[model samples]
Target: MSTQTDSKRRGQAFAGAFAGVAIVVVLAVVFFVVRNSDDSDKTSAAAPPPVATQPSAAPAQPTDAAPQPSEAAPQPTAAQVNTPPALSKEPDVKGGTGRLTKLVKTTLVPGTGPAVQKGQTVTANYKLVKYATGEVMDSSWSRGEPFSTQIGVGAVIKGWDEGIVGLKVGSRTQLDVPEALAYPGQGDLRFVVDVLAAK
Candidate 1:
């Protein structure tokens, strides 16, 4: 009876020890599973959210239409030329004549245009000569361009202002200006003037 009792006690002790080891292994497995689950939750909570993306724009297509003209560079045009008026004959002014005491006006050609007014601008071709010596002084015809002046105004000599007034366009007149009306120091003069335009 003593031997049997001792063997039963030894078997009970072995089973108790085995049960304790199994309980410890189960507790260790549970601890590792809970720790691994908490670490994954913390990692997910600290991570940043994904950002949304914008769509790209479409590329432009080529066109078949022609390009427009630029205003900065313009196309060229034809050139223009100017021509002088026609005259039948140039007048021959005689020189070496006696000095004129007063202003003398002689109409060589009659004009068909209107008479010049006091403030009108006059365009004319002229031939100037000295009264005492009959020397040719100036000729607008030789210059190829006519002369222009405001008549009956103080813009020119007193002789031209007084002589050119009331003269009509297309009329050619001879004027003999005395010393006082022509130039202050220059001698008495003569002018053969062709009236071209007055406005």
Candidate 2:
């Protein structure tokens, strides 16, 4: 009876030890599975969202469309180029034989403004024509700019100094300048001057 009891006791001890080892292995496997699942959740939560790309613009294609019309530049009128105001006739200095010894002034249109005095600045529009040829030499109207000068102070030719004095603003006058008072060796010249302003 004692031998049987000893054998039974050894068998029971061995069974308890085997059961403890099985429980330890199951706990280790459960720990590893839980740890791996937590790592997967963290990795998925930390990932960045995917970006969307924009499409590029297409190039323009050539077409057979007609162009739009633009405004045209203005052409000069014949009156503005060749003719003066209707009040005065063109000068006839070409037929004269003798040298121009005197300065001649003809008021085409009389002005209502104050008289032009010596040392006063004047603004005028003038057309200069050669006396012999009647060719248009220079014109302030043609250039679209008025001429400005101080009068009676030798700032201009002696003809202008003597002729333009005592003229009033808004008057149109003709000056037949002699060679002595005109440009050097330019001969007699005709000027149709319209006095616009004087100070």
Candidate 3:
């Protein structure tokens, strides 16, 4: 009976300690919940006054210069033979002299005569055309230079001899080469010649 009594007292003391620990845990939980509720209420009540967000001003518009109408450039064609601007009509004169009548039907632009001395170096540019057809047959202009040839040395065509006579230096002349002077056995021929230099 004494041993039974001692065990019952011990049991009672253990039950009381367990009850105190449970009470402490419940109080801590309640304190935490009450503090969180107060903090939430204060934040909700004091939401910062609605910030007046101003809309950004539109970016400055750019000013542009008006477009201009451009002029068209000159164009060349094959039939026109525009190697250079259609050579402006050269002075309209026969033998380029106020006098001489043009022997050939077509127009001619001549270089002033050069008194080609006998056996001198004569640099000349020439365009030869068949008088009947007005078609160019041969020309020194093809070489792009006044060709150098000996005058009165029997090396050049006969028409060059007759046409070159009595020509002053730096003179431009048109020659209506007669059949007798050029290709006598053949027909009439037209020659446009420029005497560049004579030595």
Candidate 4:
């Protein structure tokens, strides 16, 4: 009887100890879970808001940023400045007097006037135009006012060699020169020259 009683007491004590250990383990696990959940909430609340936004404003709008000028901004091209005037040449079919010498009275183009003595100066502006087409070939008018030439010393075309000696200053004349009198095979060309200054 005593042996049976002793065995029963020992078994009860072991069962009680096992139950207490399980309860303690459950409490510890619950405490850790609660602490971790509270910590996560506190960290999230304490974090600073994004710097991409400022106070008073919700966020920085992309369109609010300063605008940048594009390389594609409209720019003028060389073609624009060089665009030549569109002038058409109409055909004149009627019976005409043809190359009328009557219209070409005086000789010398505007800017190719007379001769300047050695150490002398003369200024002028000129444009070369075809006699038949009346089309201006080239001109130095756009470059500046005019250019100067000193004559009697032969610094110009042969026609001016004899023609410009006595031309008055500030006079404009048209020199209807034959090819032989001018550039050979260059043919009778017309020029209207201005004598801007003479010294």
| Candidate maximizing TM-score | 1
Off by over 4 Å in 4: 1-119
User: Which sections of candidate 3 miss by over 4 Å?
Assistant: 1-114
Please, what are the lDDT tens digits per residue for candidate 1 over residues 96-189? 4776777888898888778989977666777877777767777766666566666665555667778889887778888888867765456787
1-199: candidate 3 lDDT, tens digit per residue: 8888888888888889889999999999999999999999999888876632210110011111101111221111223221222222222222222222324323243335446677665554456655555555555445443445555544444555556654544444455656554543435555665555566
Question: What is candidate 3's CA lDDT for residue 52?
Answer: 25
Candidate 4's error at 93, in angstroms? 22
Model 2: per-residue lDDT, tens digit, 49-112?
Answer: 5531210110011121101111221223334332335423433323234466799898978877
- Residue 83 lDDT, candidate 3, scale 0-100: 21
Separately for all candidates shown, the number of backbone clashes (residues 3 or more apart, or on different chains) is: 1, 0, 5, 14
Residue 59, candidate 1: C-alpha displacement in angstroms: 78
* Residue 190 displacement in candidate 3 (angstroms): 1.0
Worst 10 residues of 3 by lDDT: 58-67
For model 4, state the Cα shift of residue 67 in Å: 54
Clashing pairs in 2: none
Clashing pairs in 1: 96-134
Q: Relative to the true structure, how large is the alpha-carbon lDDT of every model?
A: 0.65, 0.63, 0.47, 0.44
Ranking by lDDT: 1, 2, 3, 4
- TM-scores for all predictions: 0.55, 0.52, 0.42, 0.39
Q: Which one wins by lDDT: 1 or 2?
A: 1
